[model samples]
Target: MTANRRPVIVGVDGSPAGLGAVRWAADEAVRHGKPLRITHALGVPGPFEQPFEQVVDEHDIALDAATEARGWYPGLHITTSTWHGSPAHVLVEESRHASLVVVGSRRTGGFRSLLVGSVGLQLAARAYCPVLIVHNAERWAAPESPLPRQPIVVGFDGSAHSDFAVGLAFSEAATRGVELVAVRAWREQARRWGRGADLTRLAAAVRDALAADLEPWQAKYPTVPVGLRAVRGTAAPVLLAEGSDALMVVLGPRGRGGLDDVRLGSVTQQVLDHASIPVLIAQHA
Candidate 1:
């Protein structure tokens, strides 16, 4: 399929979190003018034969999610499917044909509430398309409701992947008619030696680098109000603090020091684990 025709895919597991993901996916499909694909993974069978009834139940999960989405977005085009594999694997395969994949950050218990599920983490690391992990789904407004005038926060460190992230963030901000906050974090060894002047110079250089990186995107998206933040700290903490009330946090799958062997970067993983708002992991097709 063409890129514009690629569907917005969402995985459902019959849980409240899964249903919430369906709602978010529906709204996104409408916004992008793409079809919505609601799917359920039946999971890999064990040593013993899987029950036929379990397959039927899984099919029902996908159908129910489609029904819920249709009710909320009556005009949106949607499709439903069921696959026999792990949720992460199935969604990763589906991502090959999708524009975006969305799932909920299902909180199972106390500590888990602060982290995304195994499937979400896996998709963030491996999906071919961007993966969106929706958090605090209960507060997500209706499709026609106006979004808060919060900015879309994006982390950029001049890596090729982060450059793509900056572009995506600008598109999202423009689409929502909101501001775009581009944050670049740096570590200053001078601070440890109490060298105030050196630290000031370092901060200035970093800010100039960030501005240069953002120059082209700002020109391309002239209407998107851009805010630049050059902070002296680690990426994850700075992003989480700045995006506390953001519409969503956009990030690359990896960063400047990311190894080719590593599918996900440490900073992205840290933010995904703790972000209370939606997190979008940008991927190159």
Candidate 2:
């Protein structure tokens, strides 16, 4: 295992979803050639004190998770830690020094009740670095495995936040030696649209803007093949549908202006809540 500045941090518990996160994180760590840090957050036990054996059991579960990931990536550097704090807070703090933070889609509850767990949501909203939420089940059939040419789908709307997302997506695609799919969704403004108005010009403009936004990135990552798509209608649904065959979906939180509820944009939230593949939320520096 080689020492590196930024390690891949993952929140791990004994649950199946947690182990899936560990596996996904390990794969990413290998891709990035960075160390893997597996973390377990132990919340305070209730008034009824837990037996000594139970305490040991909890630690063992975390240890086992780390061991599994280490075994899978023999040459990868791996470390494990248990912190006494809430899972979201602990993982968020860990993200400060990590290149990326990974978490399970669901934890400790009936799966049908929620599409994503609360902890995963909190971390995605607050983590300093990129946050990846890995779903346990594969919801789409990929035309090929996530190698050689898997596409990294990014949502772009020409905003600064979207710019950040595009940059990250380009880097990830370049790193994996894969293609980058930049999608921009547009719709005619009802106020500007008249009956039987021609939308051809509007569609062309949207497509051109998307290409312009991607031009610099294309130059920066010459080896990465990029495909720009200007789709009609809402951004969320378009990106979600594209997630069907993507290795991962990269998106930025909605821009912060004009509205108090813009901390995490609704479109980004929708994709995070429903993306079948791992979703990486690119945070603003």
Candidate 3:
């Protein structure tokens, strides 16, 4: 993998959130024996707005992130790139063949604007590689401490891509000595008679079916703390609500159901919206 692609890619905006992304990218780059490349997009100014200094500022931030990464890992190579386009478009385009793309959610606008800003949301949905959205510092980190331990929550629906997500989640859990939580969600099912779907039972049955698929993995990783939860509700909301303190979040490239599944099961899409955390998206589903 090292020989075939860019080592690590992170977006920088100089905000605390962006710096947090740089921090995580540096750690991964150092641990994997890979270089760190930082990129920032020179966003076009809104109509009639030609902020020439914006480009220079964006460049400076990218370079700053590169310097920070190199400082963390002296042996870790560093490269920087600047593109004149939409941030999300440029980042996702560059992420096509890179190891991973990391970004931070900093609201240039208001509160709701931060949830899934333009660049972060687009990358989360369209990036060809994994997109990590850095939010807080474990909700409990020193001013200059290494990242803290948190559960690695993986979203699954039984497809091959979902399988890859599970494997990635397990690998991360094993590597980090952290807990792993796997959650599967389904639409509430209707009961007999002229009744609507039982959302509660639907969540349970879906959870049970998904739990069964995890049996072999459970046997193989007996010592790794694992929990399976099948919940009733939308996947994005459930995962988002539960992953607040999670070390990282992962999603299958698609879903298990089919066209409808992929279209609807895109918690990854919604997860990136205004979310603050690291996310991994497998290529298969």
Candidate 4:
């Protein structure tokens, strides 16, 4: 399928948080003019095979999610499906054809749950498309209410992954008509630099680097009011603080400092665990 036509996929598990993801996915679909797909994964059955009742329950969960999403967008082009596999594996496969995959921050059960245990991490690290984890899905209950007019915050450190993240962040901010805040975090070596003039030069250098990285995106999205912040601290903490009131926090799967063998970066993992708002892991297109 064409990139613009790829559907926005949401995994549901009959939980309040899952339903919230439906709402967010529906809005995203409308915002970007894409179809919405509501899915449920019924983990691989035992040797005895799956029971009829269990299959029926899973089907109902998918349908219920679709119904709720339709209520929010009556004209939405949407579909529902059920798969037999681990939640992470099923969604990762689906992500191959999806524009974005969304899930709730919490789940109630094991079979169909998306965020329980290592499922969320797996999807973040392995999905072919971007993965969005919606925190506090209950807050999205009302479809007519406007999202907060807060800025969208993104972190970049000149990695290929972060470059994709910055592009996605600019697109999101442009769509929402909000400011885009691009942040870069750095650490100073106390042994090499003194407190006065050295620290001042370091801050300026960091700012210049950030601005250079953002120049192309700024030209592409001229209307998106941009803010550059170069802070001296850890990536995770700086991002968490900068995005405390943001509409959402956007990050790469891994940063420049991330080891080549690691699937998910430590900073990305830390932000996912502590951020109160939605977090999106940008996928390389």
Who wins the lDDT comparison? 4
Q: Please identify model 4 stretches exceeding 4 Å from their true place.
A: 45-54, 107-112, 142-146, 192-197
Candidate 4 residue pairs that clash:
none
The TM-score values for the models, in the order shown, are: 0.89, 0.86, 0.76, 0.92
* C-alpha root-mean-square deviation, each candidate: 3.3, 4.1, 4.9, 2.2
- Model 2, 1-285: lDDT tens digits are 233558998887666677777777788899888888888877652342678787677678678887777767689888888766678888888888888888877534653222247877888788888888887522211213232246999998888887888888998898788889999888877665557546888888898988987888888888989888888888889999987799889988674231544557888888877777788888743
Residue-level lDDT of model 3, residues 182-238, one tens digit each, is: 988767545577867666676677878887988877777777799887866787888
Q: Which ranking of candidates, highest TM-score first?
A: 4, 1, 2, 3
Poorest 10 consecutive residues by lDDT, candidate 1 = 107-116
Candidate 3 lDDT: 0.69
Q: Which of candidates 3 and 4 is the stronger one according to lDDT? A: 4
TM-score of 3: 0.76
Q: Specify the poorest-scoring 10-residue window by lDDT in model 2.
A: 139-148
Runs off by more than 4 Å, candidate 1: 46-54, 109-116, 141-149, 190-196
Assess candidate 1 and give its lDDT: 0.84
Best prediction by TM-score:
4
User: Which run of 10 residues does model 4 get worst, by summed lDDT?
Assistant: 106-115
